[model samples]
Target: MNFPTHIVAVAGLIINDDKKILLVKNPISGWEFPGGQVENGENLIEALKREIEEESGAIANIDSLVGVYSNVQSYMGWDGVSYTPTKVILDFIGRYVGGDLHTSDESIEVGWFEKENVLQIIENENLKDRARDMLEFHGKVIYRVYETKPVYSVKSERYI
Candidate 1:
């Protein structure tokens, strides 16, 4: 059954000089920007700031709302429990105003890379596309929806 899932969230598509973007490589594998789920009763901007701080240990000022994404896919647990088919995430463009980029409990290595260079190592095709869209469009916002489901569970998927 398709359950009602309106998980409001915020993410930072942070950028720097030389057309470089900030991304993190986990202690495991793959690469992604700093983001997390927005908590109950918290404003979107507040959630973005809090997630950025916790994930990258940097204080950032959100620049603008870039886009809203909703992708529906199947999910299954390690123990084989079926869950919701899709989870939607709201993302924003954020700028690092102050603080240092250091490793935190949520990340292992964080660094900025050239836009061309970053595209190759992102691991997930969809995420790479999203990053490219963010860079190319700049202030232009977008809304995306997915109808298909993944063969593997969401937990095993590279990115959410």
Candidate 2:
């Protein structure tokens, strides 16, 4: 019997004092919330803070968990390779602590965007949906699951 492996990740919808949402422009994922895979031994909140700081050079105070989003699809690996996997993303609503916006190796651009502008700039449907949900969230945690096709062809030999 084959069991599917799920990659756990975390994302932060950081809102600044100006009511703008923090966004990062990743080369592969495009404009989206700042986040990455949860490191071993780190809790989801810790992972979210670390990822936000690493990717956007900003400090985040986690306000609450917005939702859990699951997407079964092909995604670019950290090594620049492509792979199909089930990505489980925990989304959090965070408040900006401090630090100027700057991009790291993982992000091409980092900046704050208005809610309406965020919806326009983020082209990925999943990301756009997540942002909208975060904005409309009313103290309740939500769960969403998405089904997607592999963008690359898989060979039986590769798996075996």
Candidate 3:
């Protein structure tokens, strides 16, 4: 018997007291919230905090889960010979606690932006959609199934 394996990641839509959102700019993804794949043996909340700090030089407290998304589309890895694993992403709402904002090796730019301006900074459609869902979150947790390859498309969505 084999245990199912997937690439698990965590992201934070962190808002400061000024209502500004934390954002990071990477070469590949353009602009996005701070997040990355979870390492083995790392707790999800720890991973979220670590990623936020590492990518944006900010300390954030995980407030609540905003959504869970699955990218069913598999793509070729950089190696080109092997396919990457399916991705399961946990998106959370976070409160900015402290620390000066700065960019890390993974991020070329890190700063706070007005909430209304986030969508414009994020160039990836998939991320923009997720940001919309997060920004529109009232009280329910959103669940979405989507594919990204030839084009990004949503297979299904649910408010939980």
Which candidate has the highest lDDT of all? 3
Considering lDDT, which of the candidate structures 1 and 3 is the better prediction for this target?
Answer: 3
Tens-digit lDDT string for candidate 1 (46-149): 99889887877777788866666766664563357756545576777777666778887768888887777877878765566566656665566777765334
Which pairs of residues clash in candidate 3, taking residues 3 or more apart in a chain or in different chains?
Answer: none
Looking at model 3, report the run of 10 residues with the lowest lDDT sum.
Answer: 71-80
TM-score versus the correct structure, for each prediction: 0.78, 0.84, 0.96
Which parts of model 3 are misplaced by more than 4 Å? none
Report clash pairs, candidate 1: none
Give the higher-lDDT candidate: 1 or 2: 2
For residues 1-160, write the lDDT of model 3, one tens digit per residue: 9997799999989999999999999977799989999999999999999999999889999988999999997899868899988999999999999998888889999989999999998989999999988888898999999998878999999998
TM-score of 1: 0.78
Worst 10-residue stretch by lDDT in candidate 1? 151-160
TM-score of 3: 0.96
Q: lDDT, candidate 3, residue 159?
A: 91
lDDT for model 1 comes to: 0.69
